[model samples]
Target: MPHNLTKQPRRRHPQRSQYGLTLVELLVGIAIGLLLIVGATSLFLSNLDASRRLLLEARLNQNLRSAAELITRDLRRASYWDQAVPKMGSVDNNPHQGITLDGTSDISYQFDAPAGAASAAGFALTDDYRIRMTIGQTTQDLTDPAVAKVISFNIIESKNKIDIGMQKIPAATPNTECLTERRYDITIEAEAPSDANVKRRLETAVRVRNDRVGNCS
Candidate 1:
C-alpha cells in the first residue's frame, strides 16, 4: 500500500486518422472527370457533321435557281423582233442556255427550225418543228439532236403533225421558216446517275423570230 503505489497506468488517448483523401481515391476522381470531357466532345463533333450537309444542299439549290432564271429569261424572248438574229439553228448555232443535272447531262437551247439554209441534218432543218438541246457532251456539235425534249413545237398544219426529229426539217428551201414562227413549250431533265433519276427539271417556252414564212419548199 505504498501510497497507492500502483498508480493507474496512464490512460492513453485514441489516435485519430489523417482526415484527407488517399492517392488511390484521387486517381479515381481524375478518371471520372476525363470521361465526362470525352462524352461532351463527341456530341459536339456529331452536330458539326450535320451542319455541313445542310449547307451543301442549300448551296446547290441556290446555284440551280440562279442559272435557271437566267436561261428562261433569254429563252422566253427568243423570237422578240424582226431585227433579231435569224430564227434558224444555222444563224445562231450558239446555244442561248443549257440545262444540266449535276453538270453531267447537258441539254442546250436552239430555235426549233432550221435556222438558215446552211443548217444541215444530224444538225439539219426538218419540217417537224422542235426545240432541241443536245443532252450529253458532243465531240462535234451543239445541235446534234440527242434524245432531245421538244419544248413547244408548232408544226401542226391542217392535221399534219410536224416531226421533231433531226431528219424532219428542210435545209435552205423557201423563206417560210416555220420553226422560227412556231412557239414551243419545253422541259429538260437532269439526273444524277448516282440517284440522278429526275433530280431536276428545267422548263420554259420560246417562239422563233425572223422565221421565213412557209418554211423551205
Candidate 2:
C-alpha cells in the first residue's frame, strides 16, 4: 500500500558539460606562441651583427694609429746631421745629399757625422750615418740606424712646397734657419693579412733638417 502512493522516478539522459577548447582556439594559441619565439630570435641576431662590426672598426683604428706614430717619429728627425761639419757621401751614384730617395720606395739619409766620436749635445751625427726607411724587412746593424717598421712608404713631392726661410724665424734664432728645404708628402699604409677590412693609412709632411739650409750657401 505504501509503494503504491509513491510516484515512480523517470530515467533521463545525462547532459554533457562543455569544458574543452575548440580546434580553432587551439590552433590560434599555437600560432601566437610561434610569433613570440620568432621575434625574440630576430632581435638577438640583429644585436649580434652590430657588436661584431663595432669590434672590427676598433681593431682597424688601433692598427692604423700605431703604424702612423712609428712613421711620423722617424720622419720628423729625417736627415738630422749633427753639429759636426757635413761631409757628403756617395749614395747610389747620387751626390751625398742629406736625404736621398731614388725613385723607388727606398730612402737613405744621414743623421750623424760620417767619422767621429759621439757628440755632447746628443744631437751630433756619429759614424757618418743615421737611418734609412724602406718597404722591405728591417735592417739590423750596429754601424747603421734601425730600419722603419711599416708596410708601404710612398713619397709625393709637391713642386710648390713651402720653404722655411730666414725671415720666418726670430731675430736671435740660432739653429732654426732653413733656406729652401725638401718637402715630402708621405703616405704610410699598413694592413692585417688575416682581415682585409683591417687596413689603415696616414699622410704627413716631413722636412729634412740637414737639407734645410741648402748646402749652407
What is the per-residue lDDT of model 1 for residues 34-124, given as tens digits with 9 covering 90 to 100? Answer: 9999999898888886675455444433434444454445444332333234554444433422211222222234333334422111121
Question: For residues 66-96, could you state the per-residue lDDT of candidate 2 as single tens digits?
Answer: 5445555655555455542543221121122
Give the clashing pairs for model 2.
112-125, 112-126, 113-125, 113-126, 113-128, 114-128
In order, candidate lDDTs are: 0.39, 0.48
Task: Summing lDDT over every window of 10 consecutive residues in candidate 1, give the lowest-scoring window.
Answer: 117-126
Which candidate leads in lDDT? 2
TM-scores vs. true structure, each candidate: 0.38, 0.52
lDDT of 1: 0.39
